[model samples]
Target: MTAIVVAGGGLAGAAAAAALARAGRDVTVLERDAAPAHKICGEFLSVEAQASLAAIGFDAAVLGGHRISRLRLVRDDAAVSVGLPFEGLGITRRRLDAALLDHAASCGAVVRRGVAIRGVDCSDGLRLDLAGEAPIRPDMLLLATGKHDLRGVRRQAAEPEALVGFKMYFQLNPAARQALAGHIDLILFDDGYAGLQMVEDGMANLSLLVDRARLQRVGGTWTALLADLVKRNTLLADRLIGSVPLLEQPLTIFRVPYGFVHRPTANDPDRIYRLGDQAGVIPSFTGDGMAIALHSATRAANAIIAGHTASAYHRALRRDISGQIRRAAALYRLARMPLAQRALFGVAGTFPSLLRLAAQYTRVPPRARSALY
Candidate 1:
């Protein structure tokens, strides 16, 4: 049996594998996709995420990420702009995931690309069934699939409502690029919010989180929904009127439980550590999902290596981010209402420190300097 097996090669899984391998523990990562690609996310990495990446020996600048220093909130013609509490980066998942996975391999973690974990048999230890190979049981398993559920060990959440997220890359013209440079713009409308920021190669990443019912009302097609949004949101129309899509179709995901928090019960499975979105999903607008993933990976890897149970790991993770998750959820709800959104922009404009406080509160507390390494 292998010492450890990790499912999903996204930020959480790769970070875990790299940490464990660097500590001289045998680790293997199973990735479904043949190559790294874009995912449905805001793609705005917060300052905490930057620090987490540095702790793992990965540099965002090396990945060609664009710097971000301001936050712009817009609704109709009224807008509010404020300097970020800390630095941030706008990066594409394609570049970020590839760099972390390559770093995992360099740290002696066996990264098996093009391998999909069909299911897991946890009767005795953890047995992972690969697509075209015999089932192998590992001493421990870490689930970090990031919003994609795996069979036989799918995560359960208590949240009843969910949001659908759509993301697309665009080639912005000089005017749009200049307008969006060094800033992350968030446009709020009825029942949804959209984010635009410049990423690597001077490309822009536009991501939206909308109520599922709202999306269905706009004809259920990405183009239709986006077109409708442009009509409804004047700021989005101004920024993206002439932008060109890089792909034939925008990447989309459904049923994203925005405020999910996983709690382990007495009957939960053993020897399986849940990381990233599998553990808990903070609101995307907070831009702390990536930080949570990296921090969870580092903490869980350390806990497991020091002889801790998966249940303990889950409880600790819940305790760590409970406050941040609640705050982000409240902010998400407030943004969904047009009146509340307008009020928020007004308040943020008047009291800029409130935005800084919100940013500070939403950050996942950094691990101890000695404990992190």
Candidate 2:
């Protein structure tokens, strides 16, 4: 059998490579970065993500990240706290991706770092064009580049009103730290919302999304936009009282095609398999992106092992997660509307179980039954 080539050594790529290599199929992972670095992500691992990681032979419990047992929604002064259906972990993508890729290497997969892919040509088999390197054509290819599109396989155009995202790390004051322990806070303000949670050490990850117009109106600078948001958001203001920023500046990602789901097309003659954000981009607030990546990795691996067509795999993944993605997108829209935000919060406050139910519905079905194994 010809070796399989996976682009982007991210959560999905590394996990899929590990699964395929462990099953005695040759696999190679190509990552552009020479070393692991932070990526723009919420970094919250749900139960499904954990199970998929375990199936890929990685132990998430040993990652030393924070334990998040509940989710709290805060809007100005009104707030509601609800129990999360499952305990989640707060670990950065930098750490998680590095560890999982290392696991792939240890599991007999050839892991190649600092190798950038220019594009893929499938007219005759699969030809991968590399930057300043010789091209190789493999039997099958898996595209796992998260939030990024390879030159040949980009997703459809994102909605015009795409949101801008920002992420920063901080060491909160004693009072704020104690108050935020064991919880993931989703704070809302005008035209945007933020999710803050503890991860690993005493450090906190604060990731926020703002409408593009709102960002442009504030001078199109991270500093200006963040200051305005903090002033308008009471809960976020309190959390940053005495915090020190860990990064010189926040990491930002652009052109995020939120709610994008890949459907097999006639142009996919290369039989390329799309994974992670390439497969679908669920709204970030739902915190199911990582789970989808892990689950997609295993499912894709299974498909290849079973000699299934790429279109068949794409259809199955789309069928499995389309409803969850749509529901989360609707919730994201409702959370942004001023009037609907208040009403949604009111309902969530009245029946906290509703929040749990939303979480359950937004998540792709668990893999324990299990297609992912």
Clashes per model (N, Cα, C within 3 A): 0, 0
Candidate 1: segments with Cα more than 4 A from true spot: 159-162, 366-373
TM-score of 2: 0.97
> Model 1, residue 243: displacement in angstroms?
1.6
Give the alpha carbon lDDT tens digit for every residue of 1-373 in model 2: 7679999999999999999999999999999999999988888998889988998779988989999999998988888998899999999889989999999999999999999999988777889999999999888899998877788777774662468899999999998888889999998887888899999888899998898888999999988987887788778888899789999999987667767888778777646899999899998999999999988898899999988988989989998888899899888888888899888888988998999999999998764227556
Name the top lDDT candidate: 2
How much is the lDDT of residue 53 in candidate 2? 93
Q: What is the TM-score of each candidate against the true structure?
A: 0.95, 0.97
Among all candidates shown, the one with the greatest TM-score: 2
Worst 10 residues of 2 by lDDT: 364-373
Candidate 2 clashes between residue pairs 3 or more apart in a chain or in different chains: none
List the global CA lDDT of all models. Answer: 0.85, 0.88
Candidate 2 — which residues are off by over 4 angstroms?
157-161, 367-369
- lDDT string for model 1 (1-373, tens) is 3489999999999999998888888999999999988788888888777777787777877777889999898877777888998889888888899999999999999999999888988877678888998988888899998888888888887654557788889998778899998999988888888899999998899998888888889997888898898887777888887889997888887777778888889977878999999998888888999988988898888888788888988888888877788899898888787789878878987997898888888778554323465
